[model samples]
Target: MSNIQQLPSRQVSNRGMEGGRRSLCRFLMPLSFPWVLLWVLALGGLVLMPGAVLAEVPNAVPPEGTYEGEHVEQPIEFPHDTHADVNKINCMYCHTYARRSPVAGIPPTSKCMGCHSIIATDKPRIKQLTEYWDKRQPPPWKKVHDVPDFVHFTHEKHLKRFVFDNEGMDVENVAEVCAFCHGEVKKMTVANKVKPLTMGFCRRCHEANDGPFDCWKCHK
Candidate 1:
């Protein structure tokens, strides 16, 4: 009778040990087989490839880097926070033609030197700007917010119509209007594009705002 009882007890212990081994194996199998991870990644990439291709239009560059949560190396480390936030300088102070013209023309070197020539002359960034001013050359500033070549967007129309008249906002004084699409320029050390500025985004905004949806409005 005692031997029979010992046999049942031993069988129960063996079953428990087998169960524990199976649980550990189940946990470790995926990690031990790295090819499983690779196969999953490959399958995901194949699934994602078509959407990635469709997201971008042909001959048009997508908005990315810096303000789009990516970093870009700029020629001059111009801090927008210092100029816009600390100094309380308006956007038109540098981007002069934002109100009157279609293109908010890049500020000439003279505009920068207007203050920088005397102010912070000892600083390296000021020295760099001074060099460019002296040479009469533009500071090779990289274009940040570029629309599709086919799309004809005018700054003056937006400022005059949607921003001031329709939106009941000020001219260039309203940071929120600009920041709606350009991100918070006053907080950035480097200027970057925040909005995708895609046609679909523009169309949605137009539909919401009851603005013109004609092809000629944007597409040239």
Candidate 2:
């Protein structure tokens, strides 16, 4: 007489189902604990310190170091201080293509005339500009911040990063961002290359600001 006890079919089915549930729980246990802990901590943080969670990440500090650039003579000495500092004009008002194009394009004669024709027609600088306008000739503005041919800089992209995409930054104060490389144009008569704009200078800034490490980003 075999002594082995046979379970009823119904009881066997229930036991098998319970064993399957135990197997499933064992498989999921490892993954579930960490995820559940993460959720709990995240919820706790949101409830206890909502401001820290919601606050915008502050922008990186601006780069430093200065260079004594040679004076660049332009056809007409543009009064940057009068326009940018005194009048509180936005940098993009004149450098209109900065937000859309690669270069912060030199303002056309028409743009100068739009203001000089009515604002300060008697000023010698304005008179010189008027002469150029009369002759329908561009003033052959010399670039003050020219980079090396190997450098691949785009004003539009820089502007988009430091101005447009930055949270808690106001567009009206775009000159502050412009000052990163161009220096304080609001204090000068003409733009000068105050920042070194050297490879090391740029690399240091990139490292500080979480910019790309790839050399191809800036070098052609």
Candidate 3:
């Protein structure tokens, strides 16, 4: 009688453990197999694609070496903070061509010396600007702020459509507009790409304001 009772209890215990093990395996098999596949796919992706799977893998170009884009830098660092921030000058005063022209003309040294001739003669920065004028050569200020050659952008149309002589508002005038695209000049000693000036970047703003974003608008 004791053996019979024990036999029934032992059978139940064995079945219960087997069920538990199967349940655990059921949970683990799917989870474990997928994990291995994930590692494989991740390895494959790195070897086959864009991120850090094979971090040591060299890029199409070497990661550490000199690279030169088309854009060039100015000879002297012209701080926008001093002129725009301190002097409260108009933007059109220098980039005087913006109102009706396709090209926003760089200020000739003569234009600069017209003021620097009196205000700060001793600064080596001003001295160079003066030298440019005396030589009849405008400072060979490189065009730092530019879009792709494919894009035919114009200061004339943008100002006519959106910006103008609204003096009180800081960002509405040409000087302010310069700050918008070029960034706060008074602060920059050397003009740099403050804006990424990419196609997507241009398109985002164009769509927002219903501005003309056609590739033809910039690329001539």
Taken over the whole model, the C-alpha lDDT of each candidate is 0.66, 0.78, 0.59
Q: Quote each prediction's TM-score.
A: 0.66, 0.73, 0.60
Write down the TM-score for model 2.
0.73
* Candidate 2: tens digits of C-alpha lDDT, residues 157-178: 8788888998888898888888
Candidate numbers sorted by lDDT from highest down: 2, 1, 3
- Across 150-185, the per-residue lDDT of candidate 1 in tens digits comes to 989888876666455644344445555566557677
Q: List the lowest-lDDT window of 10 residues for candidate 3.
A: 57-66
Misplaced by over 4 Å in model 3 are: 1-72, 165-173
Candidate 2: worst-modelled 10 consecutive residues by lDDT: 1-10
Task: Pick the TM-score winner.
Answer: 2
Model 1 pairs whose backbones collide: 66-70
Question: Model 2, 118: alpha-carbon shift in Å?
Answer: 0.9
Clashes of each: 1, 0, 11
TM-score-based ranking, best first?
Answer: 2, 1, 3
lDDT of 3 by residue, 1-220 (tens): 2342223222322344457668866755665777778867876977888422212211111111111234356776676667765776676777789888988887877678788889889998888877777788766677777766677778887666555543343332345455445655555556566555555445444644566644555666
